[model samples]
Structure formats: C-alpha cells, structure tokens
Target: MKSSNFLKYTALLVFAIAIGFFAYMVNASKALSYLSHDPKACINCHVMNTQYATWQHSSHARDVGCIDCHLPRDNMVNKYIAKARDGYNHSVAFTFNTYKNAIKISDDGAKRVQENCISCHASLTSQMVKNADANHNYDDPSVATGRRCWECHKGVPHGKVRGLTTTPNNLGVKEVQ
Candidate 1:
C-alpha cells in the first residue's frame, strides 16, 4: 500500500514540475507577445531580424503591422485562433531548433496575406480586375485569374531581400542589411 502511494505521489510531482517548467519557458520566451499587434513582437526571435528590418523600410510599415497582414480579418475569434496556432507552432519550432534557415510562409499564411492585400487595396485590385476583364483573353496566362497579390507584388512587405542569407540559428544579434 505504501509503495503504491509513493508511486502515485511521484507521478503527481513529475506532472506538476513539467507544467511549471512549461509555464516558465513560455513566460521567458514572451509567448504572449504574439497576442498583441506590435511589430516589435515579431523580432522577439532573432531569426526575424531580416524580415523586421525589411518591413521597416517597406511602404506597409507606415500603415499596417505584422499581424495585420499575417492574420485573417474574418473575425476576432478566427484571428486569435490563428495567432494561438502560429504562436504554438513557433514556440515548438524555436524550442526544438527545427525551423528552416530561410523561413517560408505556410500556405495558410500566404492565403491570409493575399486576403489582407485584396481587402486593404480594394480600389487598386478592383481597377486591376476591371482592366483584366476588358482585356480578357483565354490564351493569355497574364490575364487575371484572381492571382494573389504576392504573385505580382512580391516585394511589398519583404522587398527584394529574398535569398540574401540563411537565418542565423545561434540567437546572436546580427546586423540586418
């Protein structure tokens, strides 16, 4: 009976310790920073230095934030859900040091960015659509088939900085060029 009781206590203690450690790690990493729309929250991870730096000089910097473009505008619940999912994924990736050096957006992220671009630049996209309709040609691949904004305007947020350098994994501060 005493041995069984001891084993039960040990299991409970281990579980509590694990929960405590996880909480500590999350707190130290500023995981809650993802909940806010601040662009600086993006640079909390050293890997984001290039993106953050590029965005500083981008035209969108004056108007929208990181979350504004990256997250969905469907509703608050959906937005928070996406944020939590991304935050969890980022935390796990950073914890395991498993993220790729050249960080690429997931398909879902790309969709969100495309949606944001269409919503934000409704006037411009409408004009493009009107032009495409007038110039519609079945043989022309260039004609608008509702191509994503990034498909043509790839240099909006990140600029032409792709393929510059592999993201550093050591968490050392490097100069963003």
Candidate 2:
C-alpha cells in the first residue's frame, strides 16, 4: 500500500476509536446518574467502601445522601474542586486497596462539616452537640459516636424515615403517569 494511504487509514482508525470512547462515556454517564445518590454506589470504587459501610450503618446514612455532605455549599469552582480532589483520593485508595479511609481532612473539611451542621440546626439548640441527653455522658469518647447532629435528633430526621411516617402524600408528592 502507498505510504499516504497507510497514514490516512491510521488517522481514520484513531478518529473512530476516539468517537467510540466518547459515546461510551456518554452512555455510562446516563446510567450513573440514577445511582450517584446511593451510598452503596459511592463504595463501588473500593477506596470509599469503608466510609460507605460506616456511613450506611451510621445515623447520617439514613438521611444524608452521599452528595448532600460531600458536595461543597460554595461556588461551582469550590464544589467541583472538592469533587475532583475526592475523586482523586478515592482512586488512589482504590488502587492501593487501603482500608484505612479514615480521612483526616486538613481540619478545614472538619470545620466545614461542623459549620454546615451547626448552621442547619441552629434552631434546635443554643449550640450543636452530640449527646444532649443526661444519660449519655458527653465527655466519654468511646460511648458516644457519629456526627454531632445525631445527638439530640434521632437519625430519623436525616434518614427520611421520620418524614415517611408523618408527612402527608399531598404535601410534596409529584404525581406521575
């Protein structure tokens, strides 16, 4: 075959491969959209598996969707950066099979989470805390567990379980065909 014809063929093949890859990604994205909010879906990537499991059993899991807390409240730049950074971290942990996904986020993430929790629950108390009840010793580190939000309010409020029981269907229901 002529050298120019060979080069043309190679170029065409590469272009076809690129198009195929893009189409595959588009289809994959569609399927992923429905599952993205699921906590188990987050664990599919290995690195997040531990966190996902802990969260599933945790009070927060009942109410808080994965993106609800992980997503930043700030601008698109901040939100996407957090998402990308989280994705990169997940990929690294997944690749290494590191079970210790106990993320000690630079104190900043801790503060942000605390702040978000406090801000949302301002009406609940003078300040946010984990063990508002007298029996649950506030100081005993081992006895107490999970996000401070669960201390006064049961996991019901976060888990949507509470809403399911009390809320009327007409309140927020969107009728479908």
Candidate 3:
C-alpha cells in the first residue's frame, strides 16, 4: 500500500512539473517577441518567395518588420484567433504553392489597416496637412475617414517616409525602364 501511494505521489509531482514548464514557456515567449523578428518566419514555406526578396530590400528594412505594420493590435482572444487563422492559411498555401496564385488583397485587409493607422496617427488629425492653405477645404470624407491616405500609400511601409518599396524585378506597371 505504501509503495502504491508513493507511486501516485510521484506521478502527481511529475504532472505539476509539466504544467509549470508550459507556463514558463508561454511567459518567456512574450519577452522573446520583443527581442527580434525572424524574417524567415515569413518564408517558412514556398508561398512567400516573391515578396520575400522585395521586402528585404525596402527602406522599411531599417525598422518596422512585416508584423509591425500589417498585423494590427487587438484584444487577446481576437489576437489569438487572428494569429491562428493566419498561421493555418499560410501553412496550407505554402504547402500547396498557393502563394504563387495569391490574389490581390480585397478591401477587408486595407480597411482594417486604415483603422490602425488612425489609432497611431491620431495626434496628427487635428493638425493641418503640411500644404493646406487657410481657405482650403478640409472635411473630405476620405481624409476624415482615413480612406484618402491609402490612395497614394498602398505600398508597404506607407507614406512618403520611404516612398514605394520596389525591387529590381518589379518597378512599374509595365517594367522599370
């Protein structure tokens, strides 16, 4: 009876240790996220090779990784769901070479990103745009609603901060003459 009791206690202890280890890993991951970004994480499969090279050469390379601009912040549960869905979709696409068949982004992604841009740039909204004259009209729905920003800023790392990110391979609608 004593031997059996000892065995059960040992099993319980092992289970507790396993749970602790998992918790430790989760906690450690939050810190790791801020330390560095692995660009290879984006290209873990075949779907990413095209944008992969262009992203590497962009001025956005200096700072602001892919996640910084694209993945908008959200509540914990929503964030978890978003990350899981993205991971699953990317994995399947990579496995099947579906990224080569990637379609142009629909309006959904852009609209979501427009909200994030507003959140980040809220400080600038009240300030007049650099070239605005006193008589210039200012209440356009596009600017007020953040839609106007995307017209000229559709490329990665938006704004004139770095201009458009173009690779030697794709420079224009036709070709980079």
Candidate 4:
C-alpha cells in the first residue's frame, strides 16, 4: 500500500472512532431527553435522584417542574440556550467527579430561579414590592435588598437537608416512561 493510502485509512479510522464514541455517549447519557420539559430527565443521572424525589413530594410537583423554576422562561431560545449551557457544565462536572458533595446553584442559576419565583408569584411579589417602597423597583438589586425567595423558604421543592448522602433513600425516585 502507498504511504498516502496508509495515512488516508488512518485518518478515516480515527474519524470513525470519534463518531462512534460520540454516538455511544449520547445514547448512554440519554442526552435527547434533556431537550424535553419532562422533570424526570433530571433524574437520568443518579446524582439528581434526591432532588427528583423531594420535588415529587413538594407542593409544586402538581403544577410546576424543574424546568419552570430552573430555566429562563422569557423565551424558547433563551430557555434552550441556558439549558444547553447548564447541560454542558453539568456533564463536565459529573464526568470528572469535580462537583461538590453538596451541590449549590451557580450565581446565574440563582438569578434565574429568583426571577422565576417572582414571575410565578407576581401578585404576591407585587404586593411585597409595594410594601417595601413606593418606587415598585423590586427587580433592582439595590432597591430589593438582594433577597432570594429561597432564603426564606429553604425547603421549597428540595428539603433543607441536601447532599449526596443526606437522602440515602432517594431511590424512591421512579423511572418515568
């Protein structure tokens, strides 16, 4: 075989391997499910089982979902963009086992959640804003005093005690079809 043909075949083999690995990862990760609004998608990774179980038992389970509180609701494009970015970050963190035992939300994620909380409870939040001051500038960090709803309601969906080992019985999270 000529030197050119040997190199060509080697490159083709490498490309094939790369494609195969990518496909395998996608299937193994159930990556396509992340595109859906199904809350069960979060439990695809066992690490999220506790969250899933807790949320399942929460008041919001019947009316809201993980995506509603976690992702941007302003538009479909922003929602998916945030989802993809978060998915990549989570994948990297989980793949390398670099995540903390007690996972905490990122700054951006906290902001998104806060905005969602207010959006969902706009009537109540509007009243709070009015009572806070006459300006009705609750969105402004300086004016609103930088308070998160979760700060007061620590056990909204996920309970107060949260960690990798905190809820060992989280296996109660059922597999959704």
Candidate 5:
C-alpha cells in the first residue's frame, strides 16, 4: 500500500513540475503577446525586423496591421485556431533557428493574405473582377486561376522584402540586382 502511494505521489509531482516549466517558458517567451493583434508581436523574432520595418513605411501602415492582412476573417474559433497553429509553427522554427534567411510565406499563409486583400479592397477589386471575367477567356488557365492582388501590388505591405537580406538594424547586406 505504501509503495503504491509513493508511486502516485511521484507521478503527481512530475506532472506539477512539467506544468510549472511550461508556464515559465511561455512567460519568458512572451507567448501571450502573440494573442494580441499588435504588429509589434510579430517583431518579437529578430528575423521579422525587416518585414516590420518595411511595413512601417508601406501605405497600409496607417490602415491595417500584421494580423489584419495575415489572418483569416472567419469566426473566432477559426481565427484563434489559425493563430495558435501559426504561433506554434513560428515558435518551433524560431526556437530551432531553422527559418530561411529570406522569409517566405507558407501556402496557407499566402491563401489567407489573398483572401484578406480581396475582402479589404472589395470596392476596388470588384471592378477588376468584372473586367477580367468580361474581357478574358474564363476557361484560360491564367484567367481561370485568377490573379492574386499581390501579383501586381507586391509592394503594399512588405514591399519587395522577399529575396532581400539585411541585418536586424536595417542595414542591407545584399542589394537586390
């Protein structure tokens, strides 16, 4: 009976310690910051500094934030699910220092950005959509696939930051040729 009790206590202690450690790590990492819509949360990782800096000078800076363009406008559950998934993926990548030097958005992220662009600029893009359908062959692959807004408006937020390398201080390491 005493041995069983001892084993039970040991298991409980281990669980408590595990929870405590997770809490400590989350606190240290400022994980709660990511829950907010603040753009600053994105720059928590130094690698995003360039994106953040470019965004500051972009036209959208006055109107929208990082989350506005990057996340979905779905229900709260869907939104938070995407946020949690992204936060976990980002944490793992940043923790392992496995991110590419020139950051690239995942396919899922690209889809979300495209949806956001359409939703936000519906007034402007609605006409473009009508024109494209009216003028072009809808069966053509180029027309059928539809053009992503960023395909033409690439400099909106990040402003051609892709393929450009710079230090955290905004010093360009390699000029884009």
Candidate 6:
C-alpha cells in the first residue's frame, strides 16, 4: 500500500511539473499572442525584429497585419493550420539559430504571399492576368515559368534592403495590447 501511494504521488508530481514547465514556456514565448491578429506578436523573437520594423514603416502597415499577407484566407481551419505549421517551423528555427541572416519565406509561404498579392490587387492585375501564359499558374512545377509580384515591386512593404543588421534602430515599434 505504501508503494502504491508513492507511485500515485510520484505520477501526480510528474504531471504537475510537466504542466508547470509548459505554462512557463508558453508565457515566456508569448505563444498565445500568436493566435491573435496583433502584429506585435511577430516580434516575439529577436530574429523577427528587422522584419517587424521594416514592415512598420511600409504603407501596408497602415492596412494589414503580418498574417494578412502571410497566411491563407480560405477558412479558419487552413488559416490556423498554416499558422501552427509556420509557428512550429519558426520556433524550431529560432530556437536552434538555424534560420538565415537574411530571412526568406518558405516556398509554401511564398506561394501564399503571391496569391494574396494577386488577390488583394486583383483589379490592378487583371490585365496582366489576362496576358499571362496559359500555363502560368503560381504553382507551376518550375518557378521560372511565371512572374511573382515582388519581382517588380520588391520594395513594396519590406523595402529593398533587408538583413538582421539592416535595421539596427528598429526598436521604435510599440507593443499592442
């Protein structure tokens, strides 16, 4: 009976410790904030400070949040799925310092951003769309087959120059509640 009691207490203690560690990590990383629409959440890691700062000074800053240009708008399920996937990848990269000094979007993320660019400015791009090649889908097996919006408008929101050291004085961003 004493051994059984000890086992039960030990299990409970282990569970408690696991829960406590999880809670601490979540809070420390601002994990919950990623679920919100606030742009400040993007700055949770120092690696993203440059991106967050460059975006702040862009015209798109006045109109859209990070997820607006980055994630899919098809449905909540896909949105959160992409968010969770990207969040996991980002956390892993940031934790291990595996990300590049000049951060670039994943292929899937680039596709999403391209789709969003076309979607948001469809009216303006209608002529180009009509003139595009018959096989010019954004998902063409070869990326060289078609043009991406950023190819010509590289400096739209993120600016022409980008790197970890590019925006040294970018700490002016105020946190959102």
Top-scoring candidate (lDDT): 4
- Residues 1-177, candidate 1, lDDT per residue (tens digit)? 999999999999999999999999879888777767888889788778778867776888888889999999989999989988988888788879998978989889989988888788887767765665623322357763655667667678877665435333343535433
Q: How does residue 116 of candidate 4 score in lDDT?
A: 96
Clashes of 6: 0
Q: Looking at model 2, report the run of 10 residues with the lowest lDDT sum.
A: 159-168
lDDT for each candidate structure: 0.77, 0.54, 0.53, 0.81, 0.79, 0.80
Q: In TM-score terms, which candidate is top? A: 6
lDDT of 2 by residue, 1-177 (tens): 699999999999999999999989658544364336665556455344434444555566556877666566667688668767776665666567764634444455555565566555555533223535433333556654544444454353232223322322234433211
Distance from true location, Cα of 35 in model 1, Å: 1.3
Residue 98 in candidate 4, Cα distance off native in Å: 0.8
TM-score of each: 0.72, 0.54, 0.50, 0.78, 0.75, 0.82
Ranking by TM-score: 6, 4, 5, 1, 2, 3
CA deviation > 4 Å runs, candidate 4: 1-17, 133-143, 162-177
**Which residue pairs come into collision in candidate 5?**
none
- Of candidates 5 and 4, the better by TM-score: 4
Shift in Å, residue 15, candidate 1: 9.5
lDDT per residue (tens digit) for residues 61-127 in model 5: 8879999988889778878888889989998999899999778899999999988987888876676
lDDT of candidate 6 over 1-177, digit per residue (tens): 999999999999999999999999999989999999998899788787777777777789888999999999889999999999999999999989899977889999999999899889876667554665543444335533566778777677687554445543354435322
Would you give me the overall lDDT of model 5? 0.79
Global lDDT for candidate 6? 0.80
Q: Give me the runs in candidate 3 sitting further than 4 Å from their true place.
A: 1-37, 100-103, 125-148, 155-177
Candidate 5 TM-score versus the reference: 0.75
lDDT, residue 138, candidate 1: 22
